[model samples]
Target chain A: MSLQHALLGVLEARPMSGYDLVQFFDSSTAWIWAAPQSQIYPTLRRMERAGLITGDDEPRGPKLTRTVYSVTDQGREELERWLSTPHDPSPPRDPFLVQALNFDTIDAEKAHAVLEQFITEQEKAAAEAEAHRQRLLNKDTMLLKERLTRRDPAEHDRIARLKAHVFAGVAAVARTRAEWAREGQRLLTED
Target chain B: MSLQHALLGVLEARPMSGYDLVQFFDSSTAWIWAAPQSQIYPTLRRMERAGLITGDDEPRGPKLTRTVYSVTDQGREELERWLSTPHDPSPPRDPFLVQALNFDTIDAEKAHAVLEQFITEQEKAAAEAEAHRQRLLNKDTMLLKERLTRRDPAEHDRIARLKAHVFAGVAAVARTRAEWAREGQRLLTED
Candidate 1:
């Protein structure tokens, strides 16, 4: 559902073919919402059936017809409703944490390797999110610039910051998990 | 697959019926790994079929029967392998963050309400994780005590701390998000 809403928000900026939409998600917006083309295509069809979006086949070249999608009035309304409505908090599904929790079952050397790898993974994630957050804030990304044009000039600052908030949250969570991995490593005691 | 390993970890401590396993998950362990009876039952059967576990029908009452599950030697090896293996980092799929990212499409008043609700939900989650982290440290939970008995007396403290590490990570992430929500509200700026 969120993926559909995310796709609508992107298409709301400007109409795009499914190929462009896939590229958009894969590039600038993948940090917040990453959907494979397999999921994206099927969901797009469902959204069209639901009358939230419209898709029309347009000729790209001699051999290919690309289906371009645009958010309908209903889609805009749906996106607004989704943005305003409070969302259910994501439930805890930390498989990595569960793995760490069972660290007592493994030897100290193996546990050390696991904890060190976890730290590396979290640090890498924190770095990626922080970099993307800066891109949005600087309006360096093409999509953010595109999104800004649709908003009033006076409102553009707030719009970019709103999206940047999501990345900041991602970075903060990754950093915290990295620190917690350190805490878990300390508990080993080597006895 | 992690759920299967988590279930193995718990059953490794002591044999339990599916009903008891479900209740255990609903209570002490839900904070880390939660699976509804629907998922647990099927996965347990699948594990049995795979020779990772064995379930034997036991007499419950007059003309009544219950199945109790025990981890096999193969299951213990599987759990050990999983504990030692590095887990893939969970990809970011924050629907709430996705909702916030599109807040530019909503009114300020509605955005304020959404942010406030998120703060409240995150605060409640932080409090729950902190409480459970304390329970693990104090050995207040029956499950932790049972788990400890299965380990060497010398290793009990480290074992408990390993589990508590997961809850601590959960609490830290929740606290960070609550703070991020505050940062987001400051961006509204009302100009």
Candidate 2:
């Protein structure tokens, strides 16, 4: 995702300090996207310089001061323009799969260990996705469900069903991969 | 995925010219990973220089000669070593999602138009994935299924089921996403 657009999104919602925006990302969108504090701070300054956001000076103790940012009308317009434009395809790069396919060159035991490590990492991801889904469910899911329940029965039901499907699919894949790794490790040990 | 690893994968299966490696990528792994011809050719030359693969001089047309690549024993060993290593997380960075997040800043109609274009592209992907799945179903899938069917009903069934799940999951997700896009288009139009 474009850092600029994401910056504009939070700003458009409400004026916030760079720190606040960083917190917002951590809490709200960290599941699907993540940005380091380093990246957030630099982008905030750059956006202010570009006139996309205006920063209000807020004094700190002695040396360091914070700047609260609000999206400029131009920034909002730029975001809108971007939204209307055709999207370019992202460059394909997946290092993990690369490692998987190259396994034949390495020791079988090592390949098995790597797969085990991958399973561990995926478990963490699955946990994070679960937490994010729960937060979303808490915030908006009930309201959406109520609205859908009252509306077009079939369409609403389908959409309601799909939200469940997406979550289940992600969880199921993670669990299955973990199982495969465990079995692979066991079989490797036997060998 | 790393182009270096992908090249080795094709070589491990059988020796191939740089041209043939490119063709293999297009036919098989292009869905999960892709490397441009520009990147592939340069990498092949580098791999040869690094002693990863040896280039066989084969006669082409009148003037040009083809260089076929075979993985060196060292290269095979290197690939094996890599497989045993833990997979590094490669975070997804999608520009389109960035645009969507800031969509409120743009003209709603234009934003919807962009989504419409994406739907068209997704439809194309759905078709391609369906064809691929069908091809696999006819060949490798049947072999897998036969193995599953003839094996010990309890012991062999679990692994067979898991593998089937992976293949089916990919196909289902693609089909569902395409349907979601179509429905989303209608929602945008109505709005």
Candidate 3:
């Protein structure tokens, strides 16, 4: 999604400063859709100009003023409208697969080396993904336990199950990529 | 990897016209890195100007006068240098995750509907991946059987095992995602 849409979504949740939006993106959706702080602030300004969102509620700071943004009626209408539109998948843009396709051009030895390198990168990435997935799982578990304590046992179970499924999907993908790497290494060594 | 390095790596194997590079990228490396033909042809001309690659001995045709490219010594050195460098992971850019992160902000029912839509999309993607994995498996199986017939089984075991592992990994991931979709449907219905 565009940074604009992300910012708008955050504002729809609650009136948040640009800094808050940045923080939300980093801690919550960092793994899936991340944008730089640089992009966030500018998009906030642009959205304000377009009247999609506004920041009339400014929290005062001794040194600088922090603007808290809320979705205007127009903004909510836009988000509701955007939500109805079909979401198309972005075409894949993987470099490794590109190399693999034309691999016939390179000699076996050279292609093998590239494949080895690809495996190494995939391993590292899988490790990081696993770590992130674990952290999210822990957080989800804690949140569910808290909800259970508050007598909302149903909500706890509901969110926990959803969280589990999402992270399970992520973990599975990482595991698969790692397996692919090991297979790639074996192929390179043999031929 | 930059488009420049990827292009050089392809040429290092054998000289190819820009058109061929574009086609190769679509078929193979489209998974990793992708560049349009517009980007590929211009980059080739720029690489030529930079003395990284030179033209081939023969031209294919007048209109289709393919400009064959081979890596120069400088290009080879550059590609090798790139190979030695550590890789950086391209961050995931999934819009659905962005939307989900703010699910509490919007109408819960609407968000649930959006997620249901994503499940359908993920199912389609998983199906495509599974199909491709099966194709790879079938092709490798055929080649392995052919090798057995010829009694030249030296690399057969290695190739077969590697291909099998990679396909298994792919199928596993796809299955997990499909499972997630089923479990997720239950969670969405709970609220």
Give the lDDT of residue B154 in candidate 2.
Answer: 55
Native-referenced DockQ of model 2: 0.24
Candidate 2 C-alpha lDDT tens digits along A1-191: 48778777667656789788788777655543577788999988888899999998887879878787887889877877666888855554566655643443355577677877878877876676566445444435433444344456545433443333334334444555566556545544431
TM-score of 2: 0.67
Give the clash count for each candidate.
Answer: 0, 7, 11
Colliding pairs, model 1:
none
Q: Residue B169 of model 1: what lDDT?
A: 84
lDDT for A144 (candidate 3): 34
Better model by DockQ, 1 or 2? 1
Model 2 iRMSD vs. native = 6.6
- What is residue A41's positional error in candidate 2, in angstroms? 4.6
List candidate 2 stretches off by more than 4 Å. A16-28, A37-46, A86-91, A98-123, A140-191, B99-120, B136-170, B179-191
Say which candidate scores most in lDDT.
1
Give the share of true interchain contacts found in each model.
0.85, 0.39, 0.39
Badly placed stretches (over 4 Å) of model 1 are none
